[model samples]
Target: MAENKTLKVPGATLYYQVRGSGPVLLMIPGGPTDAAIFAGVVPHLTDRYTVVAYDPRGNSRSVLDGPAEDVHADVHGDDAHRLLAELGDEPAYVFGSSGGAVIGLNLAARYPGQVRTLVAHEPPCGRILPDAEEYLAGTEEVYQAYRTGGVEAGMKRFEEFVGLSGEEQEQPQTPPSPEMMEGWGRIGGNLDFFLGHVLRPVSGHLPDVAALRQGPARIVVGVGDASTDRQYAYRSAVALAEALGRPPAVFPGDHGGFVARAEEFAVTLDKVLNAT
Candidate 1:
């Protein structure tokens, strides 16, 4: 059974779900993609671990107390720390995808002892790449499109920017729920928060290499096997891993691999988690 709960942080009321048993494993979703995004992969991990997923502040059920402002990577990282502390789980295992991966990197660097192991999948750390200015400009362009036209137009540009145009985009294996549909309906607001607050901060975030290198937690950078080399996310993962003096661990499918290939992704995650 899954238990839905909320925690009051400094400026937001975070909504989180807990399920299964054993060691605690916290899963963090990408930009504005609330806890529901991990529904497919959570079930597989639940059998062996207590899976905890949450909606970040200003996204979905996790509402911010004040006006939505531009947020930094450390702010989100602090939220993750508060959530873990509220869950009464010290040094928990963490799996973070896309934007969430950047948060995990921040957490590992800033609050090292709070995380046992952090698996960061395809973090779009554009600043770490060679053509960083180009990538950053593209991200800004997507945000501008969102501001001018709307989510559809923005997403279209985003897809093309990430090399997901045409046949590259994968079909959903499972249908979305009513709750998810409602969330999608309100995605415009989330998109605004993402574009205004998250995009630049996360993409430009330079993880504290020295801090992370000296931190206690084990850090593992992940990249999707099917993710094209053209995508900055794939390249960023490789760059991040190299910075950490570790190789990027390859997983199944592309950016949304956890949902697109849940079974295989889970198995690979289990191995990575359990490996010495």
Candidate 2:
């Protein structure tokens, strides 16, 4: 059974879900996605681990105390720390995808003792890549599209920039419930937050190489085997691994592979986590 709960952090009210029973495995989502994105994979790991997923501040069920503003990676990391502390679990295993992976990097760098191992999948740390300027400009272009046209416009540009098409582009997404409509105000409100506050900060933010190198937690950067080399995330993951002095662990599919191949992804994740 899954239990939904909320926690009051310094600047936001975070909503989270907990399921199963065993060692804690916290999953952090990326893009504009919330905790619910991990629903498909939860069942596979429930028997062996207590899976925790939550809405990052200002996204979905998690709301900030004040008006939404540009957020830094460390602030998101701090929120992750608070959530982990609230769970009463220290040294928990963490899996962060996309922007969430950026947050995990900050968490491991700043609060190493709180995480046992951090598997950061395709973090869009654009600054670390060789073509950093170009990628960062692309993110700005995406934001500009959002400002002028709307979420769909921005998403279209984003999809083009990321090279998403065919099955990856056509994959079905779960629609929001009627109840969720109330809190969010409008359908594209979260997209506004992602473009105005999240995209640039996360994608452009540089990870603290020194802090990570000296940190206690084991860090493994991940890239999807099927992710094209042209994709920013795949390149970013490769760059991040180089920065960390380690190789990027290849997973089953592209950026959203965990969603497309949940069962296989879970098995791969289990193997990654258990490896010595």
Candidate 3:
């Protein structure tokens, strides 16, 4: 009922899993994490669609060369494109969370033809906000800490930024082993590159906030039910919905909504995605 495959992309080998049959839905994960984060959620949807989740070119099972110099959104976008191509030429519906959502937006903008529907959930594309300068500065601090002090420092800063609990923060705070660090470094490099090159420029070019207003392609903003009102993810979802002239549908749980309440989230997701 499940198959694992290795996909070779430009900078690394992507480890991915596929389940079920039907239209393909690409799930892009967040954090310094990978596909496994979606384990709980994938089962609920596999019966309705082909679910493809992969470790991005430098995370988890994926391998990469010495932290390729800065990596931009286009670089990450290219990986998504290559993975989708390998799966098949058919367009895919995409659901991306946090950093993944940011990547999804770039993919949609750059390769509009490849995306059938995009559920950009809680993207913290902070540059799109009115106070972008401060956000970028804070992000820079976190990246720098990660580079110098390691994962704990980086995660601490991230948790502070997102207002996560100390224990919840600890979940992803462990440093990557030396071997995994190489991949983390590559991913980190891309994160740095994205900050400078992609963030602001891409925000400036966003389609008329009115495009989603027409609804040929469903572009929905989803926020976690348990997320705090002030959390960046929730705020971003709110802002995106406002920009698109729509409202964000509440997902089943907190920021890791799909995983925390997989069954309910899948039901809601299916309803929303299939509505189009």
Candidate 4:
């Protein structure tokens, strides 16, 4: 069974869960979503490494001390540090997807000693993109669609970008809803945090990645098989791997493939984590 608990950070009450045993593994969930979004993959690995998944402040079970407008990456990163403290401050392996991958990369860059290995899957780092201008423009368009219309419209635009129609993209179930966002009024304060603190600073974020490349710390980039042609994530993964000078390892599914192919993905993930 999974054990749920809370950690009090600078301005947030972070809700996290622990399961399994062995080396610690921290899962950084994607943006606009919570840890529950990883339901399929989490359970499969608990029997090996202890898996810790938590919702960031202003999201699902977590709570914030200040108004949502005060949310920022410093607060979020500090919250992550606090959570690590509760785990005895021992360095742990981290697996992050999308926005969460961005966060983990930030953490690894900012505090290299905190992470043992980082498996960053498809971080949307505009700086690393060959055509960053066009990429940001597309991202802004999606954000506008979400803001002007709603999740449906935003998803529709996203589907179109990835060559999926509404009907084709629609699964039997819905992906987890985003708990906070830039346009939601709740996520307004974090925009500067995400862009300035995380983005602009990312240029020098992790010098240790090079050292890590030579040491026990390994940086693995992951892409999805199903997302090869139409997904920005796959392209991003390829770009990141190129930047890192390493070939990316293909994961089992598309963006959300980890959830649907949890068992197979989890096994592969375990092997990758241990190998690193």
Q: Judging by lDDT against the true structure, name the best candidate.
A: 1
Q: Provide the RMSD of all predictions against the true structure, rounded to 1 decimal.
A: 1.9, 3.1, 5.4, 5.6
| List of clashing residue pairs for candidate 2 | none
Per-residue lDDT over 129-232 for candidate 4, one digit per residue giving the tens place of the 0 to 100 score: 67666666665666567668766676667566544454233131334333222224444343433332332333212223454455545788888776754566
Please report, in order, the local distance difference test score of every candidate based on alpha carbons.
0.86, 0.84, 0.70, 0.66
For every model shown, what is its TM-score relative to the native structure?
Answer: 0.93, 0.91, 0.81, 0.79
- lDDT of each residue in 118-145, candidate 3, tens digit only: 8888877666577667766766776676
Worst lDDT run of 10 residues, candidate 3, spans 167-176
TM-score of 3: 0.81
lDDT of 2 by residue, 1-276 (tens): 679999998888999999999888989988788876777777889999899998888898899999989888988999999889988756999999999999999998988999988999999888888778888889899999989998889888888776563434324234433433443453356888988889888887899988988888989999987787777888888988998899988898778777667778899998898888
Q: List the residue pairs that clash in candidate 1.
A: none
* Candidate 2 segments exceeding 4 Å error: 165-189
For residues 1-276, could you state the per-residue lDDT of candidate 1 as single tens digits? 679999998888999999999888999988878888787778889989999998888898899899988788988999999988887746899999999999999998999989989999999898888888898899889888878987778878887886677636554567755655665665666877887777777877888888988999999999998887888888888988998899889898889888778878999999998777
- Taking all chains together, the TM-score of candidate 2 against the true structure is 0.91
10 residues in a row with least lDDT, candidate 2:
170-179
- Candidates 1 and 2 compared: the better one by lDDT is 1
Global CA lDDT of candidate 3, please?
A: 0.70
